[model samples]
Target: MNEQHPPGPAEAPGFWLDTPEHRQWLMSEAERQWTFFAASLRDGPGFFSLDTAGNPLSDDTQELHSTTRLIHAFALGQISGHAGADRIVEHGMAYLRDHHHDAEHGGYLWALRGDAIVDDRKLAYGHVFVLLAGASAKMAGHPDADALITDVSDILDKHYWEEDAGLFADEWNRDWTPFSTYRGMNANMHAVEALLTAYEATGQDVFLSRAGRILEFFTARIAPAENWRLPEHYSQDWEIDRSYAGNPMFRPAGTTPGHSFELGRLLLQFWDLSGRQDRNMPVTARHLIERALKDAWCAHGGLAYTLEFGGKVSASTRFWWPVTEAIGAVAALIKLDRQASDEQWYRKLWTFADTHFIDHIRGGWFPEIDNAGQVTSTIFKGKPDIYHSVQACLFPLTNGLSGHIDDLKHSEPVAMR
Candidate 1:
């Protein structure tokens, strides 16, 4: 008798619903999402986080709450032709000028109270978004773009850089002491991205150098150890942080495919910068992406949100942001290696569009999904977050519009020697 093999977990079905029909559906859906987002934008400083039922989440200092949402609104408004975007940016500019800037502390506060500062400490993620918001404001031709960038850059440079580690400090105390014990690949990755955007917007050599240094940081310190594909969290001295002091308690069961996929695209940028120096950059990127697709992705539908450092499998799925980044990364790869590209990558991207990120039933991309791929959970699902929308719109549009994958467009690389 012949032995039969079961479907290995590695070959498990993935959730992707991409098709020509789905593309049409996504475009239409994008339009609808834009309308919903535009309607949420406020003319004043305050904003609200709406639940699935469309009720405002809170009312206290709601205007100051507008900063996060405004970033997403500005990006979506541009893509969807929503008029509220103008007001959103306008309000954001005024808020940045009037409230966010901390002259005494030398960085923007995470939040502001009425004529007082709230959450005076700064988060790496929030500051990156502020940088992104500044870039978006510039794109929108807002007058405050220059000042916003300058102010945010001042904050970033003064407080975030860990000179010995040659990377960023994730969070700062009120006096701007780098206080976070655990440093994250995610935060550093986005800081590079934000700095790149700022460099693009301002053509400032300082920003470009900072971005390049971050790229080097990822290559040198962020990627995982042998047999590992995910990035490691570290301390200021670059020590692996198993203590969970500053890291999240719930580690994924395997390498995070979405993050790996995003890293692949980021590698392409670095590769482009290293052109003529090494042709293997793209090759290495291609292999990493293949690993992500093979081990980290699920076949039934939706990209897996988290992966264990040791490549162990997990049941978690249904985050929309990773899907968005996966799509953008693969799209970018397609543009870069069109000749050597496989059609399946494009199909994989489309598949995600159909299954996890798309709200085929109730509309808009659902925020959270459980392990079994069912959309039943809504306790933290489908909440309107400012960060997700901005990333969703910007990553897609950036890859969609460029159609080119060359990094020669970036500034000169920093000299690390």
Candidate 2:
């Protein structure tokens, strides 16, 4: 949900106590889950969503967005030394080549059926993910990497960019005229991420320029005033429509927690790189994150998918990917030696896992957790959907594995040691 709601103190018994036995157990569980998810990648272009029976969600339409998510997972796999990142990307390249791509339109379609493009509408959300896949293929030194990237970049620059206002539109017609009213934080954030990676691949000034323009758009147009501290979601012209604010798809009441955490991390990175002063952006982003964290965490350790203003917070029982990004943002803040409360945020992760997503009773972590921290869904688990597992697993593990805790180890050895 909003990620602001800290789980109520009324958590399930024995959550996030950090006992050595529990730490070892959870670490092992994490590794096992990674292995299981990695092995699920099949002969074709996609990975299946696993359920309790170990059956892959075979329907092609189910996970059209896995392209980006898989790339993210592969990156995480690389970071964690899973040795399967290459295989995962290979499967993705095959899928893109075999099924998902629409050669005529110069972008990817959503579904595949034995070498034929199944759904050709071209989701803007999916396009951002394809950028990730294209880049991942490049990093893996796949044969089609350069060609894939150039094609995706052309589509993005041609269709997604708003040359008049210097920002990308969320969706478009065949000629790329803007169509969707749901201007989204998710879309823009992914675009920013994709463009940065694309720039890394090709070092094209044009790609970097687009990325910078997005940062500037957020800074000037979407950023809230000092007192309000909320992200603006709207057209490139910057209107305040309800459609852009409080989307209900991810969260029932539609509070934007992920965006807040993402913006905090992105702004921190931008500030470090540019040294340009924005007196209020950082403060506002931090406030949004803290607020989201407090609101999104459930009574137990599991997280609510999103926060809604009109009703009780809506949460899923299955765990989702934003949890890791949220944790990563907090860890980055901690690394920056900034004054943000890392312990509080970090505790939220452990607490949610312990109470909800960890599946201490079953095996492997659940893909989602409901309000009470019980497994609600397994829609995104299994195989190697890019962003889902890698972001979720690696972000928390890396913070631990990276020796970021060295300072605590030395100073607070009595407890942490």
Q: What TM-score fits each model?
A: 0.78, 0.75
lDDT of 1: 0.57
Give Cα-based local distance difference scores for all models: 0.57, 0.54
Query: How accurate locally is residue 150 in candidate 1, as Cα lDDT from 0 to 100?
Result: 82
Model 2 is weakest, by summed lDDT over 10 consecutive residues, at 408-417
Candidate 1 residue-wise lDDT, 272-304, digit = tens: 543426576567666666766666566666666
Off by over 4 Å in 2: 1-30, 113-118, 173-182, 200-202, 219-221, 226-236, 243-253, 273-284, 299-302, 308-319, 338-340, 359-364, 378-386, 396-417
Best candidate, lDDT-wise?
1
**C-alpha positional error of residue 378 in candidate 1 after TM-score superposition, expressed in Å:** 6.9
Error of 1 at 190 (Å): 0.7
Per-residue C-alpha lDDT of model 2 across residues 267-347, encoded as one tens digit per residue = 555454334366565565466567667766555554455544432464433345557667666755554554525656666
